[model samples]
Target: MGKEILDLAEWKSTLTAFAKERDWEKFHTPKNLATALSVEASELLELFQWLTAEESTLLPQKNKDEKLRKNIEREMADVLVYLLRLATVLEVDLSKALQEKMAENAKKYPADKVKGLSKKYDQY
Candidate 1:
């Protein structure tokens, strides 16, 4: 397994250093990042929002917009920075905990039972 790693502040500092290396600080202004985040998030949401049951399954297969695709990726990166910054401030370990939680959830929602099911765990 990869090493268990990265204090929150470390991730934040690393991200800041990366941005600085590329002179991305000006482009990464908090407000602009926030706006980009919102726009990117909207694109991700557009993937599923207001779709019919069948359409939900087909959306990803349908033609995608360049703007929406780029926005979604950009926004997700923006969100990650803010999240990392917050985690740094709070001194939390995001990656390890997330991996553990996902493992726990997979056990709870096993593929054998959930493969074709839509109801939540409580409903299942």
Candidate 2:
């Protein structure tokens, strides 16, 4: 059997229910959610600290044991959850925002001009 798929609305509803159940919605203001999202992102980054680039890329390999991989997954989920919560509280449409940002980035970093380059848009 395949895993269940959840759309953004479903995720938002689930998160809302979770917060409501715990009386946590009052604490989930946009500012608080953004701060929590940043903290969670930092926690995720800490997992990769001091690792060589290749080691960081290989962290989820089965042979490496599940503990580190699980920690990474948990931290990533925390970051995503807080981000979603923040977006919901702020009434931001994340899908549309991401698509618009991707379009803007494409214009800023055109493949023909910026291929294989790591410079910022203005520097390229």
Find the candidate with the highest lDDT and give its number. Answer: 2
Model 2: CA > 4 A from native: 1-6
Q: Please provide, for model 1 over 1-124, each residue's C-alpha lDDT reduced to its tens digit, 9 standing for 90 to 100.
A: 9997646666689987887799876676556666665666675677557667875565355364555556556667666776664454445687777899999999889999899988898887
Question: Candidate 1: TM-score?
Answer: 0.55
TM-score of each: 0.55, 0.91
Residue pairs with clashing backbones, model 1: none
Native-referenced Cα lDDT, model 2: 0.90
The runs of at least 3 residues in candidate 1 whose Cα sits more than 4 Å from the true structure, single-residue gaps closed, are 1-11, 16-64
Candidate 2: clashing pairs of residues: none
Distance from true position, residue 37, model 1, in Å? 8.0
Which candidate number maximizes TM-score? Answer: 2
